[model samples]
Target: MGLVLAAGAGRRLRPYTDTLPKALVPIDATTTVLDLTLANYAEVGITDVAIVVGYAADAIAGRVNDFQDRYGVTLELVPNDKALTWNNAYSLWCARDLLSQGVMLANGDTVHPASVQRTLLDARGEDRQIILALDTEKSLAEEEMKVIWTSENGVRTITKLMDPAEATGEYIGVTLIEPDAAAALTEALKLTWQRDPNLYYEDGYQLLADQGLRIDVAPIGKVDWVEIDNHDDLARAREIVCPS
Candidate 1:
């Protein structure tokens, strides 16, 4: 399977990124945010990785390439030149040729070993798209881009995180998709982002759900992942990964 690391302007994590990309910011003596995610995937048997780079992509590219050179993994590069303008769906679409069989999509800003393992394990038997959902110590808010399900069945509905119903929790930015679903999602992205240039990947997934696609939410029970949105997130994540 393939993995697409969504690349974009991390406007939320400023100042630190005033000089460096968020993904390249150091977490510890041994890892960066993106490095931890990449290493997690490697541990769980993901060999082929395609990282979509933009928004200070050169550093992301250099760091990942350096690691790949040392570790010998199949690390491919896909550029989201429009990352400044478009959302993550467009990033994955740019790398569709590398995802012919199927692929996993990840948020470059979040990293944790358990979270990576859970996403891969949960997506194992799925025949369709599987979006990773996490329940947490603090409930994810209505603006965090969440996923929810009402079915005794495993299939679910992913919304903009603004729906009144309390979700299991937030998206961990991990999604598994077969090639057909990936193609369908890209097509949906075309329609969704045509009128509005600021569309996110959630927009495409919502389009798929609206059209009756079987999008499964792979629930990861309160796990050890961290989403680096701001300085606090960075500090907290660094503490978790680099408690010295």
Candidate 2:
């Protein structure tokens, strides 16, 4: 099972989202951003999916229902209790029970390239969690997460959003986690929630990796993958996912 983070009001994506749920914002003639993402997941045989939503949860559920009616995919709505002052970590907590031992976690705002699905399917039962990493050989900005891999081997540690000056590339917002690591995520959240429930999943991952948990990177860059945050990204991703 995979968990999709769809909670939180699209504050950055204002006015337009004032009336419509951002997830329902269309990216093509017959698809919205969420539609494109969920449809692609279904295309890859991922039938179990939970989308954590907050503001406009009902409307998002309606969209999910519509998708199920049309595409016949299981896109359940998981409501986040605290979506106001939190990042995506809270959404993960809300969708916790929906996930299985090895779960795929993706941002609802991004349409991950279909090629990344192979990395996820291959990650099942792997020792370390897998992350879709951008090639470090490319010329990236100075503020990227420099990769320090052990070898070309399958197991390694991934430090996210590392110092860009010393980093080589970035994360494409696609990840696959092992069962134990998924359980560890819940444990790490229990510790942090005592202090702050608004923490992001990145914090737990970093902590677990620091504690010597292996985190592997699945290389992907050739396909078109875009993340939509502001209006500009929305426009850009629309073109990539639904090029006419």
Q: Best candidate, TM-score-wise?
A: 1
How many pairs of residues collide in each model? 0, 5
Residue-level lDDT tens digits of model 2 in 82-132: 776676666676666644456677777777666676666665553555454
lDDT at position 38, candidate 1: 69
**Structure candidate 1, residue pairs in collision:** none
For each candidate in the order shown, give its overall lDDT on alpha carbons: 0.69, 0.66
Q: Residue 182 CA error for candidate 1 (Å)?
A: 2.4
Off by over 4 Å in 1: 136-138, 152-157, 160-165
Residues 1-244 of candidate 1 have per-residue lDDT tens digits of 5475647667767765765666776777767777776677677677778888878887766666677865556787788888777776677667767655777677788876646565656656636465555543446655576666645544365566466356655777777776667667777777777757677767777777778776776667657777887878888897788677
| TM-scores, each model vs. reference | 0.87, 0.85
Q: In the order shown, what is each candidate's alpha-carbon RMSD?
A: 2.4, 2.9
